[model samples]
Target: MAASPTDTAPPEQGGTPGAAAGFPSLEEMQHWTWVIGRMQQMMMEQGLAALPEVPGVNDAATIERLHDFWSDSLTLWQRFLTPGGAAEPGAPPADKRFRAEAWREPAFDLVRQSYQTIADHLLRGIDALDGVEPAQKEKIRFATRALVEAMSPANFPWTNPEVIERTIETRGENLMKGLQHMLADIARGQLTHTDGGAFQVGRDLATTPGQVVKRTPLYELIQYAPVTDTVADTPLVIFPPWINRFYILDLTPEKSFIRWATQQGLTVFMVSWRSADASMKDVSWDDYVRAQIDAIETVRDLLGVKAVHTIGYCVAGTTLAATLALLAARGEADRVASATFFTAQVDFAEAGELKHFVDDEQLAMIAALSPEGFLDGRYMAATFNLLRGRDLIWNYVTNNYLLGKDYAPFDLLHWNGDITNLPAKWHLSYLTDLYRDNLLVKPGAISVDGTPIDLSRVATPSYVQAGREDHIAPAESVWKVTQHFAGPVRFVLAGSGHIAGVVNPPAAGKYQYWTNDAPAESLADFVAGATETKGSWWPDWQAWLAQRGGGQVPATGARVPGEGALPALEPAPGRYVTQR
Candidate 1:
């Protein structure tokens, strides 16, 4: 047989045989091990240097406290070391609390203590430094936090006590399920933590009755059926953020803002934005503004109104402000009678944690990955989850991966998971011209449809709402619009994060809002004089709209269209919204 084939075959050059061959080579693994060892050594040195001499360490009181803590910790450690027993030292005093069950282990208790001490000392070191820029400092803090999170003992299955316990209890079922979920997520290119069938777009959610009066390449104009005998003469047109579905505003019968507004005897119109695809990759900022203008015109023509009350939510509000600027430049400033921004910012100077991901290098990387010149929604969803890693990423990893529990169906989580793509040109333009450049505030830095955009010139009476705890657009940033826009601006600071603050209805009765019309130089000044109000901001906003709404008229079941238009395209929450 001239040297058997198996004997003549060369050994694999890569790492181990079987499935392990797909992983890093032995040499590469060794190199990383050395690198990590060096990093840990360096961190220990920095931490030691950052530590101050303990004040009165030898004092009786200090010694007593230390002894007590050590005794308690050692007792807990002893109990944990015993099989079939659960005893663990609680986490140390730290702002970012760890929730992992692995800390129940005696070794893990020490691990956490060491990590916390290192983190605190590192943070103090950064603070003691003299000349780092604020943004750079923020970057350093975020990086340090990320590193600390990554190095948690709970992150590794073999080292994690809880994962070990779960594996024993479930007899490897949990591990198998975790592997399945991980593979599924990899297949989908996204982390999904809710049942996909939890809510159907038209039937379960976005169920409010309305008609899609017109359809454009970019959006569908939904003219809702009146809920009352008569409606406000000036129709209300809402521009919802295109990143997610428009259904968020029309969630369910009880929580729907659209339903609430229509019930208040106001003609409601919503622009349901289309999910961008490769075909829309070249769509620019100007294209979006143009589509918005068209929607406004279409709604105005249908309702037979010269001017309409406009509302924008989140990034949609930013879009509205820019559109208003475009309209003003074209001598159509009167097209909008009033403007309402819900947790939206025209200025990006103080845009909170979101700014950390928008630097030049990150932008370039995103652009390169968008080969079709569009960012897929799945990627966007992943990127957003990373922004709140503890809650969105690790929590699910623990529940679905370590515990093998299937995700519970949640409407909000489902909506959140149901993402929409962003046109490459438009996204890049937003990040560059608006976010990075801070162009909208700069007098003539931006132009749309042959018109230079300047927000300061938009004097239409405006209602600006900001969430007090909004990590996306800080209330202070949203409030900055008041200083820039020359209008009678009413600023409302609601008590929650970005979406919850805006979605809050009186029925929920969860959060309160603050109001103060006294002109103040800055957000801090305004907040200082503001008085807290009970209940939702919805009623207050409706009250404001009631002031500017043109007199009421008999509500019509029939759809109306402006000059040179066809009949209703289809029923509301139309085709575009139902698209996957």
Candidate 2:
């Protein structure tokens, strides 16, 4: 330092004697390295734990049992494999081989690990049994023994391919008839051959009635009735799901809900969702809500009514709820007097197996396929078929195609086949936000026009009905809606599935429902303390509506306009019916 400042600089500091060091100490570096290594180890362990374990070798007694079971299985397999046996001489190998080099050591280790795990679990269970009461111990022992018995491989049936073939051949004619019947139905109007025997007769008997009266850029208002006396005071508006045609409610004289309501001294105005084409690709949920609101206003102004009662079915109910929520937020509740929902999904927490089809993966696939902003009718039909494969898919496969019988001409089936295309934007939003995320029940989770859909704000007296055997919309899922509405709610559990439940006529037979004499504190509490009654919910609903409808004012003396130059010329069934 006395000679020169630069020469006196410390090597570590790269400066003169008093300069401070910048680099970390060896001990600190080691500590950081150890921390990073530990974190990586934890991540690796977690990754391994996430994987499903492979089944392997058993303990001594269990091994002996499994060996005997496998010996029998191997013997059966050998019999099938034999060249001279009933099975064909050259058949594909049934066994799936593992990679010997990659899997052998791991498989052996897994076997050892599995045996150890079983032994440990068995010991723990025995120890736990020792601490329990004698009766409880006996019950536990019985349960454990039953579980073990259930786990035995012998419990499974040995499916013999030859036997299966023989049985199928024995009933081949009936099966063939059923197959032919289904194929005939599928090909009916869609296919044709040169021969007269293979000509198409597409849905000749299942034609939908009602023509479009007026077509707007977005929708066509389809009128089905002879414009008779308009009951201005008790004007009714039907909100059918856009997924199907409006004819579902007006199916037939006997099974028609709209017809029944009209006969009940009410003027009905039904909304037929116009099938969307390329022009309507950008249509959103907001557009639907606006269209419906406009419809209600149009009906009121045209008929000179103060307000109207609205009935929504299935997905339409959700739309109705959204509209009501919007109205309530904007202080426009005076437009609607009351609302009725038929098997609507307000809360989707317990949506059941339908949830499987609307999961992230399926929805992504739908989005990819429907990039143009509408789900194809064929895809929708396929999804619905999967929900009840045995009924919708296999039943037809067995009956129509296999049996070669003519399918009975039914309006409901025809309507079911005539599926509507869903706008891609709305469909994706519904799947991701409502079904998957359950945003409807979650406060402030959904909104329209930047205004949140607060379900509690839906104060209009509501009548919600759910079917007992509804596979699509289960009773439990529908019942969840009671808590979401702040209004006087009547929750009715009906007697059939999605379609039959809503289409239920008075003469259908005894149906049942549950209602609160007084509003319950919560849906769960209400159900827990509720009593079940036997009878049709239809009469109960009729009584309820009559009470709220203010004893039905005398029929207004207004007449509906006739179809011609007086009403503007509209396309047949309008353009919407054929959009999808």
Candidate 3:
């Protein structure tokens, strides 16, 4: 052995000679195993660190400490159950009286049920791990076991009655606050009713300001003074979504985009969607397109403009796209000079969870509810609220109900709460054909008035704007319009969700947009290629319209043609909005 070093090695070191002298000690191997196990446990515990903090809580550190303590205790118990543990197979069961006592309450029982459900699922996962590789098996086993242990009912802080009682008391206090707020709103509504009647009576006492005398059958176009000196060669007509009131662009003095465009010298005319009536129950998508096209023709005849720039918002965008495509296919592309879509869904593949509620079964239920021909306004409002439960529903509960605060008087909220009804037949057709089938994006997938809506035929100059955080018409889905339009397309990605993005005013705090004329392969690619800016989209839009609007012309002095002949419906922002 002294002459040949190789002959002195230990067999466990896989050496026939003295090379075994460098083998790791058994103590070192055990220490490494212990370190790796602890590391895995720590990693598992840290995986859910991104979860939001509990509301009104101050003991996050304490909760984490408690979790660690329980995890360690569970590890110890698991180790005892292993083959190396001293405890025999039939050894006396560990005391479970504390666990039983802790879970005796209803809240604790609910926690136990949740934990047991998770535990059972994890066990099933472990059982399915038989086919996995050895290393992967070990990791999965560690993860599953650690998760199950962590989810034990005993780890829940609310297992203590004191915590549960405190939470209940807090909730009760919030509810009282919400009730007070609701009562105040009711009082305000009553006051408004009294004041509104008085204002009508006192109307003759005040001098009437010089108002615009433009008389177009279109209520929205009434404010736009027709060009008398030199009208633009191209006409402009807007197709606003019927889901909301037409005044989204005409919100208020400072916030109105319509007003801004008018001031910037653009001949703008918005579509005032007719409120659905019992007689309009059977109106379908074709009827809407026909009506809109008729309106466009009327404008063309009146203004003697060669082509019109058509702009659409939300659902109206899809309708406009369809109409443009239909016109192009029929060799009538000259009718439209350009097309702009705001937060519209031409492609429905990625329309998100709203699609979940538009399936066949749900459609049938909706049909049943709308047997009289239109989906009720309250029903639509409820559906929208469901999509944003935490923000729209729970936030109100916390602020108005729980905190005992006075209801914040906001015009925006009032406008939002002003719901609108949808014609049942049209709504059904929209959901089934557009959403369920995704017909608009596909060639010849949908037909309006027997004309296939082929996007390849749309040669108008196009501008499409989508919101980044829009849950209703997601940016990705809206961006699909670019693929459909065969024109110089400018896609804009705006900040905020669907409604806020469109209603954004030229305020300092407002967000801007990213736009590109270059063709984008996908929404992600477009975003990657663009730069960001800050400010409302109003200014940019104003600039764009200015370029297309030609020079400023003298305002026309015409009165609405059918005003005296037709019924003088009540003043604008009518009775229905104030109903609820």
Whose TM-score is greatest here? 1
- TM-scores of the models, in the given order? 0.82, 0.65, 0.65
Off by over 4 Å in 1: 1-111, 158-161, 557-566
Encode model 3's per-residue lDDT on 1-580: one tens digit a residue: 0112222212122222322344333333334434444444345445424223545535665455445444544444234223343233342223231243424432233334435545665565564544587544654665565556544434332332323332354544544555666676467432110112222211321111112222232223322533245445555677778776665665555665655555554565555666665767878888778767876776666556677788889999888888888888888888877788889988888886577677568898999999789887667776676566545654454344444445554444554565667889999989998888888878888888897778877888887889999978999999888887787777889999888888787764688788765666999999988877786776776566556654444445221222322332343333332232
Report lDDT per candidate. 0.76, 0.60, 0.60
Which rank order by lDDT, best down to worst?
Answer: 1, 3, 2
Query: Candidate 2 versus the native: TM-score?
Result: 0.65
- Candidate 2: give its CA RMSD in angstroms: 22.7
Decreasing TM-score order of the candidates: 1, 2, 3
| C-alpha lDDT of residue 524 in model 1 | 86
Error of 3 at 394 (Å): 0.6
Worst 10 residues of 2 by lDDT: 1-10
Q: What lDDT would candidate 2 get against the real structure?
A: 0.60
The deviation in Å at residue 446 for candidate 3 is 2.1
Q: Which lDDT tens digits does candidate 2 get at residues 239-347?
A: 8888877677766567667666656656666677877555667888888888888878866776567778888888888889889988998999878988989988888
lDDT by residue for model 1 (1-580), tens: 1112122222224433432323343334334433443344444444434334446576554454444444444433333233323333355334333455545333444445555555555565566555799988887877776666666555666545566556656667898998899899889888877878777888778888887878889999888777788888898889999988988888877888998988898888899988988888789888878888888887777666899999998889998999988787778989999999988988999887677778989899889978997888887787777667766787777778877888898777888888898898999889887778888899888888877888888889999999998877889899898988877899999999788888887888889999997878988898899999977999999999999987988775343332225477788789998675
